[model samples]
Target: MKFSAVLALSAAVMASAKSVRNHYPVRRESHKKGASSELQSQLPAGMAGFGVSNTQVTEVIIIWTNPGAGAPTININPPAGGAQPPAAAPPPAAPAAPAAPPAAPPAAGPQTHHVTVGGPSGLVFVPDQIKANVGDMVVFTFMSQNHTATQSAFATPCDPLPGGMNSGFMANPNNSVTPPPQVAMQVMVSDPLWFYCAQANHCGKGMTFSINPTAAKTQAMFQSMAIQQKGKGAQSPITGGAPPAANPATPAAPSSPPAAAPPAEAPPAANPAAPAAPPAAGGGVQTGTGQINGNGACVCAVTCTAGSFPAAVQGVGSFGGMAGSLPMNMMEA
Candidate 1:
């Protein structure tokens, strides 16, 4: 019941109040789709100890309309009064936003585009990563370079390329390598973008970077990489590919065992008969014609014969006081 009464009173209070208006400059044409808001205030009626009492305001709102290419048209209003409005109704409860710390002024009057950088590996330069703003119409030069200063837009399935929702404009610089009349694109503060050095593997070399993005997240990513490097590794979180096998042995061929014993001398005999070495099978003499008076020795008289079993030795074969017709160690004569 009380809530209903308060609502009625709030409406009545707003109906009786007066309003004032004035011009508030629009941010810029680039901020066409952008929006800005502010808060205003009204003080209590009197000075301290004299007649000051904090009163509640009824309500406050910003009414915006378009202003053409010429001087901007604006109106700042203050709510009217009847039975002192509640404190909640005037300007906003929140204070006016502090003016943005002024951006560094553009280089003295369009200085020559002395600052020149390359597109990494034929890749288009990523926008926000380049650290430029809407008014910064930068010229990026390429050489058979496939680089583009593309926008990082806020579209569903978020993409950073030719098509994007919150995209900043892009431009290509003209150089001897590129065609004449260098190109450029002025960027806006509202977008984030990324790019690569397209000549395969260039980005992996750290040829890629970004600008004026949500600074902290990138800082953490890079910082972590650095901290890890202090230990080991230069890039992402993954660690780099194991140690070898133990020693192995080979076998040798089997060898023959040494001989058992040295040879011995033949035993000497007492009456060793002259070895009748049966006439050397391949070289011997027949004795059919000779009379074997005694078998002591044999001699070669007329029938000259060679002897065997003794090299360079002469022998005599005789019996019964006659020279036996026999040869010593004979051969077929």
Candidate 2:
């Protein structure tokens, strides 16, 4: 709304006033090329006060330069506030408790050390790089097409802005909108850093740039990040791979004692159940009527009857007269 008012005032000034001058907050910035409205180009990292809490900004003043104007062709004015009608105005906010420290003057820290960036030919800013010292300060002031001094670093591996990095607050929604980012930038290293449009194809061609106190190996890194980003744009990510399943440990089987021997020529069932005893070699035994035959080596049950089991135990209860090996066989012989 304030911007609309400033624009309205601009149109109004173009009509009657000899030279219109308005007051905006003060700021420091750089020059750009082919810019439509008076605008400041690329700003620094902390200008919007992202990470560093010790940072501060004082003012923002928009100075429109007229082509072929008189002595003071410059019209420095603060952003106007009458754009939105009262109907559009928000209700007045209730006053709150005074600030603990109260409001300090705008000149809290060093208000100098100008940082500005330029585009390309047929563009607005040139080189489009803004660099500053660690302790130095910068002020930005401009009004032109959609532009910004994004307050995030050029992360490696081209990782998308981690959840909280890019605030998305300063990015201009529309193309021709001018959202001036008055921020203070400090180059921690004498080395330069590169930045680009997070937008789709805007930075791919030649819309990329760098900032450093001195020339170094930053250009190579920038090119590397760009290449990786381009590769990701080619195809989708890998699929069909999942973490391996865990192997469950098998439980150990319980060990058992060897089988006992069968009783020697036992009487028939009517003779009464015999108590089980240790097995004789090459023999079988019975426990509470359960007969346990010894295998050749490990005593389990039965004998070499390995190939295919008989329909019944070979000599089991021969006393029943089913097998000729019964004691009655001896009597009959």
Candidate 3:
């Protein structure tokens, strides 16, 4: 009965040990025959029964089963002490800072600048120089006299630049009360700009202006150069119109004078004539004084009886009376 009771207790303890080994890791150790005997002696007395010898009872065999192929671990029992302090809680997270507002944009609108041109102060741009950015405007108002705001180059301060801006002649006559004429130009770049008055001799008198001038190229220097150039740089602004006509050709002179004409010829001469006859005695007659007949012959006056005069005497004269007688018969009173 004692052996049976011991056997039953051993079975129970073995079952309890198996339960602990299955739940946690364990290590196996072999004991010597002496140690087995010592364990048997520690058991309850009178275990040698039911045909079991004491030596056989002292012989012990232990079987250990391990399901995993892992290294053995050693567990150290905690020292007698109070429980471990709770893990310190992590510091509370700092509150996030408030977000900043977005920044504002810069100004981007265009601006305008006013310039007085040719005022009573003389030929000049009231503010001869200025600084301007792109998209800015420059308006020129003519205050006195005729003038023009014409773009030019630094090299030739008075001459107009090709394809450059030009305000046509704005005439602001003296003592005029009306508003002066205005011309405007928009800045397209930030580069330096040169300008001049295109009026006669105005540029020569140093009427010049500039925009965004550098130290090396200043408005005063440009005006000085313009003055030195005098009217040489002055030019007419192109206002579309007909071109000037070309000059006519000159006439050539004659090489020499012309030739003169010849003189006329004379006529032929006529035959000579004879002398005349004398008058009869006691006859009242006139000689050498005669009249021309229808036949173009001359006849003389004489006194003679109708039948007494000879027929020869009547027809004796050819052009006039005979040598000493009347050529025609005459009667007494």
Candidate 4:
């Protein structure tokens, strides 16, 4: 009897379970259909038929007006052509810095030119004339004894030109002092300038130099004028910007003894036609190894007031070393 009671209870439990199972499926289907209908009603007429497929879920974008204040009403769809809006134009690039004109190459530095104040042949300045610009420096190396690099005017070669520069006397005869002495001066002007040895009569003997002379104002003309002036160089400081003076007088040629001729028109007499006196033999002559009056060696001879020395000297003879100073013998005579 107990076994039969147990069997009846089991049957009752089974039937109740079956009824709950059947109702669960029906509720699930109804809930799903309600959700689908609500979604379709909210969609626009154009998107009404666009529903999620059984295999895949549809994507929808909802746009709301005045965010946080209004509900979403429009659904944004991706463009059909798949084209994207161009990104905002990059902020106008800062105007390209005007291409720096290739920086002008720095102006060339002032040039330094070297000139021998007196070469081996002491009577004359080596490369006596030169062309120099305003910024250039001309170094005059006084390599010999008893000489001065003095500034003078083209019009007055031996005499100082106003506003000119002068290098004081540098007497290095026999390389007597150590370190081989020299004097230097910068070319401060572009116009023609003249220089000479101011030691006594050096200027008269053709110890002169020039810079940037014009066609009309030439080096030869200046030397000729200096020989005529026959003046000593006055003390001058280094300076520039002096107005040029009138052209100097041409130098008179040394008069030679008249050739034996018929006494018809005699040549005009030269007032100071004395023969060039030769410098003393030893030590008095600075540059070359010859007598000034020897073989027409010296043309323009002048007296030296600065010590017992040759007042002037010149490189006139054929010998490369043939320079002549005021001959002591000539001075004695």
How many steric clashes between backbone atoms does each model show? 38, 24, 11, 9
lDDT of the candidates, in the order given: 0.32, 0.35, 0.59, 0.55
How would you encode candidate 1's per-residue C-alpha lDDT over 240-321 as one tens digit per residue?
2112344676666677898878778677667867877655443343454433677655443332243333333332553344
Which prediction has more favorable TM-score, 1 or 4?
A: 4
Please, what is the TM-score per model?
A: 0.25, 0.28, 0.37, 0.36
Model 2 C-alpha lDDT per residue in residues 275-308, reported as the tens digit of each score: 8864665423322323346534332223221233
Residues 1-333, candidate 4, lDDT per residue (tens digit)? 699999999999999999999887666467889997886565432222232223343221111101111223233333122323111111122356666756767557555455665646767887788877665545555566667666666777888544345455655667554444443334445767777888888787677888898899887777766666673323112112234565998999999999898778878787887778766554443433435645755434344333332334444334753244444564552
Model 3, residue 189: distance off in Å is 0.6
- Cα RMSDs of all predictions? 27.1, 26.9, 45.4, 44.6
Q: Candidate 4, residue 1: CA error in Å? A: 99
Off by over 4 Å in 3: 1-108, 175-177, 231-333
The true-structure Cα RMSD of candidate 3 reads 45.4
* Candidate 2 to truth, TM: 0.28
* Model 3 lDDT tens row, 3-102: 9999999999999998998877655445677796786564322221211123443111111111111312111111112222111121123357559855
> Could you say which candidate leads in lDDT?
3
